[model samples]
Target: MDYLDNVARNFTKKYPCYLIPNQSEDKIKAFLTDRVKT
Candidate 1:
């Protein structure tokens, strides 16, 4: 969870949109899903 928290923090720094609490969860899930596919 700590690792993911760090990733989320870094990600939000890069993409400010991810800071939206409501959308962040789905966005992060989608991001991880896409990464896994690649």
Candidate 2:
């Protein structure tokens, strides 16, 4: 759905890799947090 698309878009925009569907939410949260630090 749209939420997933938004997450995918934002994740791809901020990170070097596409966020895999199997990735844990904790990992995604950590990744986003890491981005905010830099």
Candidate 3:
């Protein structure tokens, strides 16, 4: 969980225009899947 927290922190720092709330499991999975595809 700490790793994920750090990743979120860095992501937010790099992309301040975006917001990542406590989304649903499916949304998180989809987001990760899209990232992996790229």
Candidate 4:
């Protein structure tokens, strides 16, 4: 449960767009990675 909760929190914080699907992990990863590049 803790692991799941942490992932949930991280996902939401990193991708606050509620309209996006949670299954889009790759998209989120790319978004965050791009953010780090700047």
Candidate 5:
């Protein structure tokens, strides 16, 4: 969970403009999936 927290923190810092007002589970899942792939 801490790893994910750091990842999310860096992601938001790097791409603040990419955020959405209503983030969904599916979107979070997809982001994690994509991150895992790389």
Candidate 6:
């Protein structure tokens, strides 16, 4: 589970404004589902 934990930590560190565990899963899913511009 270390890899998952690191990804979570890195995502939080990179996105300080986005809510983490407390955020609605839908929001997170939306972001990931959206295609990246680059």
RMSD for each of the candidates: 2.8, 5.7, 4.5, 5.6, 3.2, 5.1
Against the true structure, candidate 2 reaches a TM-score of: 0.40
lDDT of 2 by residue, 1-38 (tens): 45554675676667646545546444666665666679
Pull out the clashing pairs in model 4. none
Predicted structure 1, TM vs. truth = 0.49
- Write out the backbone clash pairs for model 5: none
Over 4 Å off, model 5? 20-30
Positional deviation of residue 26's Cα in model 6 after best superposition, in angstroms? 13
TM-score of each prediction: 0.49, 0.40, 0.49, 0.45, 0.52, 0.44
Q: Rate the local accuracy (lDDT) of all candidates.
A: 0.71, 0.59, 0.56, 0.62, 0.63, 0.54
Residue pair clashes in candidate 3: none
TM-score of 4: 0.45
User: In model 5, what is the error at residue 11, expressed in angstroms?
Assistant: 0.3
Q: Sort by lDDT, best first: what order?
A: 1, 5, 4, 2, 3, 6
What residue runs in model 2 are displaced by over 4 Å at the alpha carbon?
1-23
Q: Count the backbone clashes (under 3 Å) in each candidate.
A: 0, 0, 0, 0, 0, 0
Of 5 and 6, the candidate ranking higher by TM-score: 5
Full-model lDDT, candidate 3: 0.56
Clashes of 4: 0
Which model is ahead, 1 or 6, in terms of lDDT? 1
- Candidate 2 lDDT at 1 equals 43
